[model samples]
Target: MKMKGLFLAGLLWMAATGMQARGMEHFIDELASQQEVTRVSLGTAAMALGSMFTDTYGVKHIDVLCLEHCSDEVRTKFGQAIADLHDPDFEPLVSHSENGERTKIFVKIKDEMIREMVICHVDDEVAVVRLKGKIKPSDIEQVIQDHGSDR
Candidate 1:
């Protein structure tokens, strides 16, 4: 028997465009692709390890890391990025899956024009891809509000 996959192509979204630059240099290697990051940096170590599932992913703390490889600037920038995350922007990208599971990701490009980011996967692995893009708690809240869901 043969099987197909779920694929999403050419998705572009717009954000509020009212955020401050939070230069964060997180994300080391791509467990997946370039536009899609396979790792993130939360607050605690557990959160980092817990960042393997793409789906059901979220961080209760202000700090997090998806991997063990982090530079001091990246670490400091991560904290500062979170602290500086004022408002986040959303630019839809390509999403797809082949294992019968759907792969969803949202890339944060010019958040405050100082940070950049890529979305790896969601609802599959313990992963929350953040590519050093400027983002605020409210921005995340906005997504939850829009999606009618929360963490």
Candidate 2:
């Protein structure tokens, strides 16, 4: 009888865990759908995607898709700094929007990088899919200029 109870508990736990995982996935999708993702770093494990939103505190705001935890201040500063270079919002970061079923923009930050993903552009359904490509802190504009439309 004890064994039966333990087995049932384990099954219930597993089911609960699975449900939680699915819920998180849904949340991710929902969160990604509503944002102006600027730069995304696919390589670095740090915060790779930065969502730009200037809160009342003048703090930079970013939502990275990497595997790391960043304080609100750090996110704010980075977002603000990045924004300053381009209309203080990085809207032009959506450069070279080649019409594809999907599209991505690579954002470079200082130490680590993050990716900003956009999904289903063809269908007018933009979603923060994931890190689009490698990111770092460098002259992204210069690199693009020098590299000639590769990055």
TM-score of each: 0.26, 0.24
User: Which lDDT value does model 1 have at 5?
Assistant: 25
Give the number of the best model, judged by TM-score: 1
What is each predicted model's overall lDDT from 0 to 1? Answer: 0.38, 0.38
> lDDT, candidate 1, residue 99?
65
Error of 2 at 133 (Å): 14
lDDT of 2 by residue, 69-143 (tens): 344554444333322322111223353344443333433332354333222121133333333344443434445
Q: Model 1 Cα displacement at 82 (Å)?
A: 20
lDDT of 2: 0.38
lDDT of 1 by residue, 49-115 (tens): 6556542234432322242244444434433333233324444444666664344344454534423
